[model samples]
Target chain A: MTYCVGLLLNEGMVFLSDTRTNAGIDNISTYRKLFVFEEPGERIIVIQTAGSLSVTQTVIAKLREADEDPDASPYPSIMQAPTMLRMVEIVGQVLSDVTADISAKVDRMSQSATASMIIGGQRKGGSPRLFLVYPEGNFIEATEDTPYLQIGEHKYGKPILDRVVTPETSLEDARKAVLLSMDSTLRSNLSVGMPLDLLTVLTDTCQVQHQTRIEANDAAFQEMSHAWSKALRESFTSVR
Target chain B: MTYCVGLLLNEGMVFLSDTRTNAGIDNISTYRKLFVFEEPGERIIVIQTAGSLSVTQTVIAKLREADEDPDASPYPSIMQAPTMLRMVEIVGQVLSDVTADISAKVDRMSQSATASMIIGGQRKGGSPRLFLVYPEGNFIEATEDTPYLQIGEHKYGKPILDRVVTPETSLEDARKAVLLSMDSTLRSNLSVGMPLDLLTVLTDTCQVQHQTRIEANDAAFQEMSHAWSKALRESFTSVR
Candidate 1:
């Protein structure tokens, strides 16, 4: 299982994903679920995936393959897509195709190879856009009314986001919101673990402004988690 | 659908449940999920249920009928149970029997007639006890390490309880904790709604210490909900 959240704010977009993946309780391993595709001033696309890892890895591998193919004129790569919507379409199509293909092979076992993704980024001329792409190749874009999208282990962390997030929120505040959201999920669910992948894409920049990996014992994350817990306790106590 | 939670604290026990039951989004109605059976000065038992309303209603009705039967003996009513453990067993057995009986009649439709319950109380000489009874006549007790049990649409309200509840928590704080937990669930899930039922049992008292029903527009509940939302926003803003 994984926990990934993407926030679309006026200043930019914030993306966060936990790295833990497990076949079972004893087979846990860390795998980065955040992928970044950049072309400097041209475009910057970030994808955070959750679900059957095999399907996501295959979809991503195919996307990267198309980007490097010498005869890739007809193939729509995330790097060469003309618009953010087109890029999302390409990613969604690839995800759907990969899942269908893999699921066909595993059908006899009653297993699913489906995966969902949160894809957000910008092209030079367009505004920053965020979308939650479904495993079936369908997707929904974030609007002013709902500026955040999350997949996997989502319910435990949702109330906070539902109450605190807005499109007008600053990037700094947005980052904190997503991190705290992830913190709540990490505490309640054992399948989602760290180190976490965090990234910010500033509007119009078409480049990654800041990115970092928060390890299990990272001091900053520890402090933030501790602070949030203490604050929550205090808040409950003060609420009459 | 329903949302019910029970906490076992050293001071006593706290139980809270939402009253909404829905056949579909268009068909929603209020039904009390909390039932109290007390032989004041001897025992006090509370049952909070979630799942197939019909099955729970039947189970509760049967229990009441048995208690009222002039010839009732040998078959233990909750009020006649020798201990809190026996009381939980009696309730679990009744719930399982009722569900199985109803499910057999509806099996062809592929619909489930399962319901779960959180039962907690104290007998005259016993300490407070809390159990989460499953649909299959089995149950698990809340321990010092994890003093709360929740059923139906539980995740949204879990993080708060995971952080704030303990065996040593005061009954006042415990009541507040469960209310806020219910508030979180109410905000996130349409299936769990107002006219919440809240009750508490003090250790060795063998009677309900407090009980109330909070309506949709109840002033005190509204104030608490508003205060919580404001405090959460402030906490989020204060987190560096």
Candidate 2:
């Protein structure tokens, strides 16, 4: 299980994802699920993945292979796609192809081979965009009315997002919103664990502005998590 | 789809259920999902249900028949059960039987006929007890460590309960906790909606203490809902 959220707002975009992956309770392990692709001042793409680790990791690896070795394919690479929409098509096609390839091999044992992703970033002439890509090679973009996309272990953390986030929200507040939302999930669910990846890109810059790995023992994160819990308990008591 | 939660607290017990039922987004109806059976001084049983309406409604109807007309059953009826444990057996047996009867018919059409329930109450000689009954006719009681049970559309409402309620929580605060939890579910999900049925019983009383049908236009509930949203927004902004 995993939890990843991407917010598209007036200021820019925000992406956050947990690092935990598990085949079963005893086999839990930490794996990086957020990938960043960039050619400064040209194009920037951030992908957050959830579900079948084999499929997602392969998709990311394949994307990177195309990105680093442009001659390996006839089509343009992720960083060379004409627009965010075309880049999503490329990612989705790869995701669908990899899923089908793996499912055929694993079908004899009745194992699943599927994954989903949330992609958000910008290419030079296009405005910023955020999307939730499905395992079936289809996708949907986040719009002003609903400017956020979440995948995997999402319900426990959704109420806070539904209550607080919007298109006009500030970049700083968006960061806090996703963190607090993740805080609620971490407290309620054990499947989504810490050492999170947090990233932000300012609108039109086509570059990663701020990025950090929030380890489980990160003091600032721990303090904010504790403070949020204390504030929620206090606010609950005063609701009515 | 439905949302129903029951909490067992030191002071008493709380049970709440939404009234909406839908086969799909287009076909929805309002129906009562909470039922109470009490002999005032002998025993009390509260059942809140979710899942297939056919299974739940029949379970309730058969339990009622066994209670009101004792000659219809060969075994001890729900009201005549010797203990809270025995009462749960009676309810579980009826739920299982009804579900099996319905599933055999619905199976031919490739549709679901499964259901789940949360039951909490006390007999005159026993302590308060809460149990979640699954479709397989098995059940698990809530413990001091986890003093609440929820069925159907529960995850969105879970974080608040995890943070606020405990066995030491008071009955009044327990009511607020469940209501606010339900409010969160209502905001984030479309399948769970008003009007809601709210009921509470003081421990050892063998009877209900407060019961109310909160209609859609309910004024006090509306006011509390508004106040809660305001308090949460203010708290979210201040958490940093």
First chain of candidate 1, TM-score: 0.97
The root-mean-square deviation over C-alpha atoms between each candidate and the true structure, in angstroms, is: 1.9, 1.2
> Per-residue alpha-carbon lDDT of model 1 for B1-240, expressed as tens digits?
789999988888889999999998999999999999988988888999999988999888878877888266334677877888988888888888888999998897888789999998888888889999999989999998999999999999999999998888999999889999999999988999999999988887989998999889999889999999999999888889
TM-score of every candidate: 0.95, 0.98
DockQ agreement of candidate 1 with the native complex: 0.87
lDDT of 2 by residue, B1-240 (tens): 899999998889999999999999999999999999998977999999999998999898888888888887654687888788988988888888889999999989998699999999888889989999999789999999999999999999999899999999998888889999999999999999999999999988989999999998998888888988888888888877
| lDDT, residue B156, candidate 2 | 95
Candidate 2 per-residue lDDT, tens place, A69-143, comes to 878854468787888999999999999999999999999888888999999989988999999999997999999
For residues A23-141, write the lDDT of model 1, one tens digit per residue.
Answer: 98999999999999999888889999999989999888888987888376345778888888888999888988889999999997987778999999998888889999999999999
Q: In model 2 chain A, which range of ten residues has the least summed lDDT?
A: A69-78
DockQ of 2: 0.86
Over all chains combined, what TM-score does candidate 2 have?
0.98
Relative to the true structure, candidate 1 has a C-alpha RMSD (angstroms) of 1.9
